[model samples]
Target: MSIYIFDGTMTGLLSCIFRAFQFKEFDVQVSTDANVQTGLFAEVIDVASNDEHAQRVWQGLKLKASDSAFKQFYYAFLSEQQQAFQHCFNFAIYVFQQQRDVSKNYGHADVLGMSQWAKQVGREKHRMEAFVRFKKCQDGLFISLVSPDFNVLPIIERHFKARYQDQRWLIYDEKRNFGIYYDLHKVHQVQMDAGAIDRQTASGHSQSFCIELDDEEVLYDQLWKDYFRSVNIEARRNMKLHVQYVPRRYWRYMNEKTL
Candidate 1:
């Protein structure tokens, strides 16, 4: 089997698809930087990122798959999981031959895995929408930090940008090590330095201050915690349900316990 290595971008994936078509005569294994290593007796091919090649693959996908299927594939592509990439690539090829209806074949392991990953990624996206709390900085910028299990930073940008149009903001994902910085004019990806990030206040933009909870802020936070604690009626409190709704990993960031 021939092994194809891609650059790990949407365009790079498309280029790989193009190359795969050219080498259809052989069985191919696709991989990226995170998990690519040449095995004994395997031939490795690197897929070049080309706009035209990407466009061609995109056009083919649009024709073969429904809009919903295309979106599912796109999000699955961004899952950053090695298995997800393989499943998505295989699923895309399956769609090319059998069309979007191939999803009905749930018996396939790859199809089931893709669906599970998409559901997980989708839920994280929704939670970020519901739970993100932005604090206004000294410069009138609203900022927040998140460390979502999945790379949902890119997905959160559009929602925050539209909801808080007039404000400048930065939302950093500590897990992914990148952030979205909105400077009123445009939103861009930002890399944080360890030194700068260590000095960040609750506002997330301050370079030389600790996040001090003032009396009012502390009171508000306590009120929120009280409300959260009070709302859980002991009779109806199901640990399983609570864990399902909000995972424990995210509890560390909840205002009541997040401090």
Candidate 2:
């Protein structure tokens, strides 16, 4: 058994595939920094990520597999589940073995698993987009904090960038300790602390984080709460359906939920 350790990026995984094919190494296992379980009998090989080698494998996969397969495989990687690399590796190998596209081959465990995992990741991405609420900071930046189940900051970048093109904003993932910032021109990933305004325990504004750039922001919060209340009918309210759409776990990040 041979264990290949990589940096846990798509390029890293593709680079491993390049090496594996070059050496005809079949009995293989993949280990990423986030998911490493060393085996006693396994010969450990450290893989250096090379974009050229990775691109060759990627282009080969595109020729051998369908576009849907390629997309699901990508989403599966983002799922970040345990052994996700293993399944993705297996699926890639399977695609290379076949001359034509076999994306709907549910008989293959790797194919089925990747498809299912992609759905889970896609659902989480949509939830992150809807649940994220930005607070104004004194620096005139719109800052939002999120701790999603999967690494979905990448998926929501385009949505926010297009929606708020004129504004400077930051969407911080507290769980991962990283954030994505857009400054009118382009978006960049940022790494920093949550800030001194740790908690929002104020009367009308209570959430995971607090930032006050403009006092008018407080009035906006109140208006949002009042709008929700005015439109809501007590007799027609359904907690079960509401919880289904906006899970209780994510309620901590929503200011309107506090009201």
Candidate 3:
């Protein structure tokens, strides 16, 4: 058994495929360097990420794979699960070994696994786009904090960038400790200083940012809450149906949910 260790990047993953084919090492297992596990008898190989090698494998996959298969490969990778990486590794190898498109071969575990994982990641991306609510800061920047189930900040970037093109905004993923900043023109990945803000406060459900909110933004929040309150019909309330559509985990992002 051969174990291939990579740097946990899309390029690194493609590089792994390139090496696997280059050496004709068919029996293999894939893992990121950050979370590598090995068997005592297994032969372990460390893979270095190379753009040229990655691009070659990427171009090859694109030529052989159907459009849906190509998209499924990327979305599955974004899932960030160790099992998903293994499925991607196996799925790519299967694609290269076959002459026909095998994307719909649900009987094959790897193909089905990749499709299922992609759907889960895709669902999270849509939920983040719907639930994210930006709070206006004193400096005129809109900021929102999210802790999604999957690593979806990259996937949600285009949606926010297109929708809020004229304004500057930052959507930070507290779980991952990183954020994306949109300056009227482009979006950039960012990180905040450890002591830059307090993550929690006495009221456990507050935004708790170190920065101050604009006075008008606070008033706008209150008015929005009042509007929300006025529209409620206690008799028609359906907790089960509401919770199904708007999960409890995302309540913190909605202004009306805050006290």
Candidate 4:
């Protein structure tokens, strides 16, 4: 038994595949260094990320896999689940070992697992795109805090960048402790201390920012909440259905929900 530990990156995972073939190790378990399991009988191998090796494996997969299959594999990796990583690793191995396309082979556990994982990450990506709400800062920067179940900021960046091209915006993932910032020109990944944000805002309950907010932002929030209340039909309310569509976790980012 062989245990292949990687750095939990796409490149690292691909490098692991390259090393697996290089060493002729077929029976292997993939794990990130952070989640490595101890097995006294298993031979442990640490796969370092190598761009050349990764690209070689990627190019080979591209030749064997369809475009949709390629996307599914990438989306599954973005899920960042330990099990998903192992499935992705196995899926890559399966793709190279077989002569025919294996993407639609739902009978295979890795193939089916990758497909299901990709769908879940895709749904999270769309949800983040739809539910994200931003507030204007005194410095002309719009900021929003999010803690999505998956690492979805990478997938949702294009939507926000295209929609808010004229303004500077920051979408911070409190769970991941990183954010994407668009400077009206390009998008950049950023990291900062939570102290810069208001405790209430970070908690998803209050709009009071630690830093100065745009003077009209509070009025805008109130007006929006008032409009929401006015249009809400209390008698026709269906909490169960509403919560089904918009889960309780997302309520923190909604102004009407906070009110």
* TM-score against native, each model: 0.80, 0.89, 0.94, 0.94
Cα lDDT tens digits, model 2, 116-227, are 8888989999888888888776778988777788888988899999999999999988787889999999999989876744645554345545445666778887888899
Compose the digit string of candidate 4's lDDT tens values, residues 1-259: 8988888889999998899899888788888864577778988888899999999999998998888888899999999888998888899889899999987788999999999999999999988888888999999999998888989898899999999999999999888899999999999999999767764544556545577789999899989999999999999999999999998888777888774
Which candidate, 3 or 4, would have the higher lDDT against the true structure? Answer: 3
**Candidate 2, TM-score vs. the true structure?**
0.89
Instruction: Give the distance in Å from residue 67's predicted Cα in candidate 3 to where it truly belongs.
Output: 1.6
Clashes of each: 0, 0, 0, 0
Q: How would the candidate models be sorted by lDDT, starting from the highest?
A: 3, 4, 2, 1
Candidate 4 residue-wise lDDT at 209: 59
The number of the candidate with the highest lDDT is: 3
TM-score (C-alpha) between model 1 and the true structure: 0.80
* Reference-based lDDT, each prediction: 0.72, 0.82, 0.89, 0.88
Model 4 C-alpha RMSD to native: 1.7
Runs in model 4 lying further than 4 Å from the true structure: 199-204
Candidate 4 lands at a TM-score of: 0.94
- Cα lDDT of model 3 by residue, 165-228, tens digit: 9999999988889999999999999998736766556665656678898879888888998999
